[model samples]
Target: MSRRTPYFFLLPAIVFLAWFMVVPALQIFYYSFLNYSVFSASTFVGMENYRRLFADVNFWWTLLNSFLFILVTPVLMFLSLVLALCVRNLQRGTKLFRTFYFLPVITPIVIAGIIWRWIFAEDTGIANYFLSLLSIPNVHWLTEYPTTIISIMLVTIWRGAGYYMMIFLAGLALIPKEVEEASLIDGATIFQQTFHILIPLLKPTLIFIFVISSTAAIKIFTEIYIMIPGAPMANKALVSFLYQQAFERFDLGYGSAVGVVLFLITLSFSYVNIKLIEQRG
Candidate 1:
């Protein structure tokens, strides 16, 4: 009955969030404290799951992998920004180019992973086939430790950068044209205008992209699951390993614990990013 009716309109979404996101997350935490099994009923187990997690070498490897992915965000940010700038400066076909670039972001991850697996194959894959014509030996891309990680990282960058580029392009477009004109009138070099004007104004968009990309990077599973598949000596990311433990091994407790740890690490980074963005603003 009141003029503040939008609050009532939003109530259903709030309820849905609580029912789905909030409740499932709390259940994951509770299950992490239990001895859960796919083949049997769960029993209370205190922090044993978490203790086992801390002592596991694979867990540490995954943690390191997660951090390594965070490092990728800056590289992606630069690529996205560069592409956005290029598109912004273009006078023709910008829409067509944007659609082509962002197609991977919308493609199903399973399909993308499968396609990449073939391309990365050592001998017969198109990538190595062409390389061999130039006399480069076929590289075992997915069977090696660091190389496997590197291959996954490369694919991740290719698949993700365009979406962020679009986001950045939108942010860049919203900047007042007169501000840029003023900079040009004052004889600001392109580098000076970008570093001093564009970046500072895009801080909010940057923070949003960072949080989204960092979280998505940590949860990387589809590619590793499709490509690596327990290849001996290859260090898979933590999420893929957790999938093996939970669904493959039926060790639900440990898997849920790993998920909890991943969530906490992501949350910490998101919080720090928010604070840094606020300070800069």
Candidate 2:
């Protein structure tokens, strides 16, 4: 009885996850092989949905856009690390600075997105107002694809950097002071210490953040949707494509196919991350 006690304590969470996550994921996999939709009766149509998925040009574009979004992760990693370092080295107002920096993360995404929408607005936006200070033309930020994507990407960074910074700060705090003292006593420069000793020690934290950020980037929908409501089909995120197909068009089967692909991609990427980490170990 004692040996089984820990498992009992964990059982509720396991059951909860199985009921909510595993079951729904399995249903999506099953639906992807069917011709299920709201308007029509479901029928088994093995691989037909996937065939349609591959054949769709919009899907390819969205996939490419998703990959492009992955670039946001490394940029996030850098920004977060810098913020963490700055906060760590501060002698005063540490808690205040941390709270201010993390303020965006706690803000509701809808409110943040809405506020950013105005910031990126073509004519009356603050962004253009600032650009005008430099004598640059009024760029149609939300209207143009190249700039529109970049603007949305910036919003993501704005909201996410603080969260990642918190993680990095926690990791930095766990490092022993002895390690830094030893390095300093060896006459290591600040840059050398950071690159060689500190960062290398924070490898696990960095890997964890990378995995999390990359997954979020691939699954990004709300930020893109809220920022660029009128974004063209070719620039939509993969999840946006799935959302439109499922909810808007009522093509649940095809959307499930997309979901299945996304699931596989995320799974494979996580596996690769783990394998790389293990190999390094």
lDDT of 2 by residue, 54-153 (tens): 9999999999999889898999999999999988889999899888888899998888889999987888999999999999999888888777778878
Q: Write the per-residue lDDT of candidate 1 for residues 135-189, one digit (tens) a residue.
A: 9998888787778888888888889889999999989989999999899899999
RMSD to the hidden true structure, all candidates: 2.4, 1.8
**Clashing pairs counted in every model:** 0, 0
Structural RMSD, model 1: 2.4
* Whole-model Cα lDDT of every candidate shown, in order: 0.86, 0.91
Worst 10 residues of 2 by lDDT: 144-153
